[model samples]
Target: MSDLLIGGAETSTLAALASPVTVIDSTTSCQDVDELFRADEHLGCLAVHGDGPGRSLGLVSRVPFQHLMSGRLGYGKLLNTRRPVSALTDWSPLVVHAATGVAEVARQVLDRGSSQRFSEVLVADPGAPLRQVSVTDVFRALSGELATKALTDALTGLANRDHFLQRLQQCCTAPDVRRRLALVYVDLDGFKAFNDGHGHGVGDLVLQVVADRLRGCFHPGDLVARLGGDEFAAVVQLPAGVPVGPAARQLGERVRACLSGTISLSSIVLPGRASVGVAVASSVLADGETLLREADLAMYRAKAAGGGRVELVTDVGSTAPREQFAPDRRELQRAVDEGEFLVHYQPIVEVGTGRLASVEALVRWQHPRRGLLAPGAFLGAVADAGFAANLDLHVLEVALAQFSRWQRNLGRAAPRAVNVNVSVQGLLHPRLAPAVLDALSRAGLDPAVLRVELPEAATTTQLDVVRGALGTLRAAGVRLTLDDLGAGASSLHHLTRLTLDGVKIDRRFIAGLLDDERDAAVVVMLLELAHSTGIAVTAEGVETRPQLEALQEMARGRPTFVQGHLISRPVAAEEIALPWSGGLHHLHAHVPGPRSAVPTAPGPVASS
Candidate 1:
C-alpha cells in the first residue's frame, strides 16, 4: 500500500486510514457542498449532522453528489442544484469503530450491499466527527500485512530467508552504482551443544538475544535477517564514495563486539558466541547469490579459526587481517590522558512550568578517528578494561566546572541541580563519593546541587557496595537517583535496601506509553511509588506531543519532570538557556520525523 493510504506503520488500525472530516449542517446547500468538493481533492466525502450538538445525519460522496447535481437534464439540475444535500445523502452508510482492524473493516465493507460496498467507510470515535476512509485503502492495508507475515520470522521478527534474498536481489540488480553492497553473515557457535545441554527452550532464548543484539548494533537503514535456525545475515550499504574495505571492517568490528557478550539467563549465564563473515560486492557488477556464497564461505572459515571474530572477503580475493575488538586497560587510560572525552547535557523540565528543573550531564567520546561516539559504543569496553571509575570521575570533573560556570553566568536562573551518571564500576568503587565531593568543592559548587544517577545494573547486583557509596553521597548533601528504572532484571522491591532521592523512568516505558496499556500502568505505578515516597520523578525519552501529553496527564499533581528530544536533544552545555528562558518556547513538542513515535533507542550517557 502507498503511504497516503496506509499513512504509516500504525496503519493496521482503521484510524490510520481516517482523514479528519468536518460535520456540515444538514441544511447546507448542494451548491456549497459541490464547491467544497471541487476546491479540495481530499474532500472525497463529507458528513451531515442535524440539530443541537449535531448528531450525525448521513454521509455524502463526491461521485453520488455530482450525479445528483447534474441530473438527467438541464431542467432537473436547475431545480435541485441549490437544495440541501442531506435530502440526497445516504443515511444508512456503514459506520465503523476507529479501533477496528483493517482486515476486519475490509471484510465488513465487502459484506455490504454491492451498490454501497465500494463507498467510503464512516469511522466513528468519541468526540471526533465522522471520517471518510476509502474501501480501496482497507484492502490495500490488508494485502500489505498478509504479505508481511509471509516474509517475517515469527520468532525474532527479522526478515525471513525469502524476504532477505528478495531484497538482496533487488539491491544487486539495480546496483545503486553509488553505494557498494556488503553482507555480514553470522552463525552461532556450539548452538547444538548448548541446546542439548540446556534444552531447546534456553536455546531459543539465546537466539532471540542474538537477534536483538544485531538490531542494537546495526543501522536501521541496513537489513538484518534470520536465515533460519542459528544463522542470520545483514546487508550493509557502504556510504557513497567510501571504499568497501575500511567501512566493512569497522562495521564488522563494532557488530562483533555487540554480539560477543554472554547472554544473562535466569540464574545462569550462557556463553553465546558467533562466527561472523563479511563479504563485499562492487556497485557496478554484482550478483546477490554470489555475494551470499562468499559471505557463507567466509563464515565457515571464521568458525574453523575458533569462532567469535569477524572475517571479511572481497571480490578482489583479499581478506582483511583478523583482529579482536577488546579495548585494553592502557588504551582506556590513554584516552583519558589525551583528553578525548566531552559532555552533553539533556535537560529535565518541570511539566507545567516548562522551566528547566535540572540537567543530566552525559559523557561522549570525542574520538579523533570516530567523530562523536555515544556511550553505548564504548562504555562496555570501558567496563571490560576496568576503567569505568576513571571515566566517571573525569566526566564528573568536567560537568562540575561547566555547571559552576553556568551558575556564575546565569546567577539565580541557573538550573537547581546537575545530574551525573555512574557505571557499575564507578558505583561500586570506594573512591567515587570522595571524588565527586572533591570535584564539587574545587568548583565551588554545592554538593546538594549535584545529583548522582545510579544505573539499574549497578544496584541490582552490588547493592551492598552501592549502599556504602549511597550513604556517603547522601550524607554529604548530594542527591542520588535511580536511572533507567525498569531496564534491569532485579525486582524493584529489592531496591528498598538502598537510599534514593528520585528515579528516571526508563525510556522503554515512555516509548510505549500511548500504544501499550501495560506500559501505561507501569508508568502510573512508578509515578505513584515516587509520590508516596516524597521523591522526584523524571520521565525520560518523551518524543511526541501525544506521548508528552500522556505523561503529563498520568503524572498530574505530582512533582514530575520530563526530558527527551521533544524538550531538547542532548546538546553542548553552551546551547541551553539558563532559566530556560520563556520556558523553552523553541523546543516544545517539536518532534523530528515520522519515526519519532518510538525514538531511536537512546544510548544514555555511559550505560555501562
Candidate 2:
C-alpha cells in the first residue's frame, strides 16, 4: 500500500512515516544479516553504512537478497557465504530525506505502481542513521483509527448515531423470519432545563449517568447509542420464546426505572427521568427509517403524556399529533414582533468589598394575562419554535440599549459589565459576532462592558462554531464566561478548550455550601482552578449570610463575586443602582414590592 491520501492527493512526509530501523555495519556479512532476520522475522530491511551512522552506503531488503541468494546460479556458489554484506547491497536504492513529506514520497513510490516491489521507505536525517517505514504500518494505523472514531461518540464512548442507524438497518433486514427486533427511543425529561439552569458540565454528568444506566438495563446483545443531547436509542433482540411487544415494553419499563433516579455529583444530587418509545420490526423487509420515525413519534407521545412513561408505536392511544408536543412558531414570532419580552438585571457583587461588579441580563415575558413571566416560562417554547436565536438577539439588543441608558445616568458608577446569555442557537449563528458588535455600536458602549455568557452544554454540541464565535468576541475585547459551571455536565476539559474570562459557580452548589462540606470543598477547588487559569470566579445564589460568609472564607483573600437575592432581586434597567456602597445597604432600602425578605438560613433563594 502507498502513503495516506487526502482528497486523492498524498500530503504526508517521510518524517511522519518513519519507524525505528535495524542498522548493520559495512563489514557485516551475509550470514550475519541472515541471522539478524532470523532473530526478528518482522525485520523487512536493513541499512548498511561505512565509518559512522551518517555514512549510509546502501540498502538491502530481505525478500530481494533472499531471492538473489536462492537462485539456481546463486552467489553462494560464486562467493563465500560469509562475505561482507556490501557485495549483496543495492548501491542505488530509493532514499528520501527525513524532512520530505509523505505526499511527495507516496507520489514517487506509487508512480512506479505494481512493477516495483517496494514495501518500505528509508528516511535519512543529517548526522543520523536511516530509519525504515513500512507502507503496511501506516495503512493499518490510519484505517483502524478512522474506523474506531467513525463508530464511537467521543464524549460518552458509546456507539454513535450513524453506527446505531446501520445496526438498526441490519436488524430490520436480517434473514430470520421468526426473530424479532425492538427499537427503543429514550428522551430525558427536563434535560434542557437542567442544562440551561445548571451548566453543560453537570448536564454532561447526567448524560453519562443516563448512558451507563441504559447500558446496564439491556442484554449483552443489545445496541445502545446516544443520539445527541439527552436522547438515546437502543436495539434489542427478543428471545426465541418472547413476544416482541411484551419484550419491548419490558425493556422500556426497565430503562425508565433504571434512569429515573437521582444522579449524585460531588455535593449535588440531580433528579433524572426519561420518556421512552418502543417500536418492533414486524417483518424482514421492514423499513429502518420508518421504524425509527415511529419510535421517535412514540417518544414524543410519552413526553406529551407528562413524561417518565413508556409508549409503544402500536398503541392507538399514543398517536398524539406532533404539534401537541411543540410550541406554536407563529405565536413566538408574534411575541417577538409585539414586544412582549422584557430584560431584568441581577446584581453580582464582590464578596470582600461588597462593591457592585456587574449584572447579568435575564429575559422575562410581560404576558398580557400571565403578568410578568420569567424566561423558564417561555424560553423553551421559543426554542421549540426554532425562535431561540431571535429571542436571544432581542434580549441582547434590549439589554445593550438599557445598559447604555444606565451608563448615561450613572456615568462612572455604572456596573463594570452587563452579561447577556447566548443560547446554543445564537452562538452557532453565522451573524452572531456581527449582531453583538452591532448592538454594542448602536448602544455606543465599549465591547468590554458587554460580556457574553454561554451554557456549558452549548460548548459540547457545536464546539467549533461556539469556539469561533468566542474567538471573535474575545478578539473584539468582549468578555466571555461559562455560566452555571457546576449545574450540568461540565468538565474541567472545557476550561482548557474554551477561551473564557470567568466562570459562574452554579447556584445549587452555593446553596449547599453552608450545610454540605463537600459543596464547600468543590467550590474552593473550582475557585482555585479558575484563578490558576487566570479566570475570575463568581458564586451564584448567595441568599443567606452563612453562604456569603462560607464563600468569603473559602476565597482566602481571592476576589470572589456573589450573585443572588441576598444582594438584590433582578430589577428593571431603571432600578439598577451602581457603585454599590460596599455592603448590602442598598438592599435594605430598595427591596422589590410584595417579595419576601432574603432568606438568612441555608435555603432556596429567589431566582436570579
Candidate 3:
C-alpha cells in the first residue's frame, strides 16, 4: 500500500487529483494564467516543469489564475514577486526512505522544525525515482514539534549571559579580519542604594532602565548582556582607528545624563548616577582570558577615575619578564591581601598665598623586602591582584576616617577639602556606594567635603561601566576631579564628557610651566579649557616662586586654583589645624609659634 496520508487525507488527495492537468511553459506569467483562468474556470494552478521548479509543465489549480485575473495579484512573486520555488523548497529538506519507521519520520520532522527553514520532512522511495511517500502530512506533524523547542532566554526574553558570551567568543574567532570587539562592563551605579533605599520593585526598574540604555547602544550586530547583577557587558564591531576613545567617552556621558538628575518613575524620582568601564578589542582577542582581563582592567580604570568616566586598556604586549618577575607579583598580591597597602596624604596649597587647599591621598606598599614601593614599582605585579578592591575600600575608609579626625582635632575644620585617590576597582566594586556611604555615616562627615581625584588616562569614552558606577557616587553629593590633566587625551577629551567639579593639572606641566614656555603653553591651554567649561583648574606640583607666580597670574585672568610644595609639603592630618577664632589671619599670626610651623620663605623669591 502507498504511504497513508493522515489528517487532511481525502481532502488533500481530492485537491491534488481533481486539480487541472495542463502543461504551461516557464515563459507564462500571471497574465498568461489569467487568460487560462478566463478561458477555463476549472484551472487553479499551472505547474511549471522543465529543468527547474519554474518550468511550467502542467496546470494544478484554477484559484491561482483567478488571483491573477482579479488584479489582486501580479506575475508570479516567487520568481520575481517571485520567491524562487527552489528557495521555498528546502534543498536540504529532511527526508526518510520509504521503509523508515513512523517514529523515525516524526523525529526528523521535529528536529528540522526548529531550524531556520523550519522545513517539513518528506518520505520518498530511494530505489525508484524520488516520488513522494508521505507517512504523515507536513503541517500536522511539524506544528507539535515546533511547540516543544524553546526560545533562547527562558527568563528575561533577552539572551542569557552565557549565550551572549558564547556568541561573542564565536564572533572573536570569526574570519572577518576587520571584526572589532568592544566589551562594555556596566555596573549600575548606586543600584544597591536604590534597591535598599526603595524596594526591590524600584531596583528592578533601575535595572530595566539600564537594560534599556544598553539596548539603545546596540548597533546592527552588537550584543548586550546582563552579566547577572548590577554588571552588564556589550560586544560590538567598531570601525578601526575610529577613536573608540571618543565614542567610549560619549557613551559614558550619555549613560550619566540618562541616569542623572530626577529619574521620575511614577513620581518616585530616582536621582542616581552611573559609572562605566569599557575595553575595546580590535581584530580577534588574543584569547578569552585576555579579552576578559582587558575589559576588566578598563572597568577598573574607569572606577578609579571617580566612576562616571571611561577607561581603555591598551593591549600592552607581554613584554614584562613575568618569569623573573613572578616572585614580585606573588609578594605584592600577598601584601595587598594582608592589608599592607598604605595611604599617605600630600597637601595641596594655594601657590602664592601659601595656604593649604587640599590633601592628595597617595598609596604606598610597605613591601618588607623592597622597603617602600610606590604604585610605579609594582603596579604591574599587582595589576591583577585580588585585594585591589579591598585596598581601595580601605583607603577610602581611612581617608574619610582621617578627614573626620582632622575635623575634630582642629579648632576649625581644615581650611581645605581632603582629596582622595580612588581606584576603578573600588568604584565598580559591588560594595562601592555602600562602602562610601558607610564610611561617611560612621565618620559623621558630609560627602561634599571630600574631593575624589581620578587619573586622566581613565576618563575616556570607552569606560561607560565606570561612568555608571561614578554616576551613583555623584548622586550622593560626592565631589569629583579629573586629576593628572594634560597627560593624555583626557585633558581635552573629558572636560566635555564628565560632570566634573574641577581639573587637577598633572605635575609634569605644573612643576615646570612657570619656567618652560612649552609647559606654560600647555598649562595655559588647560587653564583656558577648565575656565571655559566652568570647571575650576587646580595646578599641582608647584614648588618654586616662579611656578607659583605663573599659576597665580594665570588664575588672575581665569579663575584657577593652585596646589604644590610652594605652599606646603605633605603633613600629618593633625598638623594642618585651623584656628577656632578668625580664619586665616589668626592662623597666620600664630604660624611661627609652636601651634603653627609654617616653613620659612627661603631667601628672596627667584624668578623663572
Q: How do all models score by TM-score?
A: 0.50, 0.48, 0.42
223-283 in candidate 2: lDDT tens per residue?
7788888889987666678765777788789888998888888887777788999877664
Count backbone clashes in candidate 2: 20
Q: Give the Cα lDDT of each candidate.
A: 0.74, 0.70, 0.54
Q: Report the C-alpha lDDT of model 1 over 1-608, residue by residue, as the tens digit.
A: 00101111232678888887767888998888888988998778887886634345688888887787777875645767678877778877888899987656755664567677778898999898768788767755654554444455656768777678867767765735314778889998888888898887888888888888888787767778889889999887777666668888887788778878888999768776889899887544344777888899989999999998889987522233223236788877787788787787877888766777788888777777667778866786788788888899988988999999889988987888998988878877877778888899999988999988887765445877567777888999999888876554342533455678888887766876786544565577667656666779898888777887787787776778988777766777766655565353344465231122342235443332
Top candidate (lDDT):
1
Better of 1 and 3 by TM-score: 1
Tens-place lDDT digits, model 3, residues 430-514 = 7666777788888898888778776564646544557776676789888888877755533545655678988887766665465
Which residue ranges in model 1 land beyond 4 Å of their true spot?
1-318, 321-325, 459-461, 582-608
Candidate 3: misplaced stretches above 4 Å? Answer: 1-339, 557-559, 571-608
Best-fitting candidate, measured by TM-score? 1
Clashes of each: 0, 20, 55
Candidate 3 lowest-lDDT run of ten: 1-10
Per-residue lDDT value at 412 in model 3: 61
Q: By lDDT, is 1 or 2 better?
A: 1
Give me the runs in candidate 2 sitting further than 4 Å from their true place: 1-325, 369-371, 577-579, 582-608
Clashing pairs in 1: none
lDDT of 3 at 581: 21
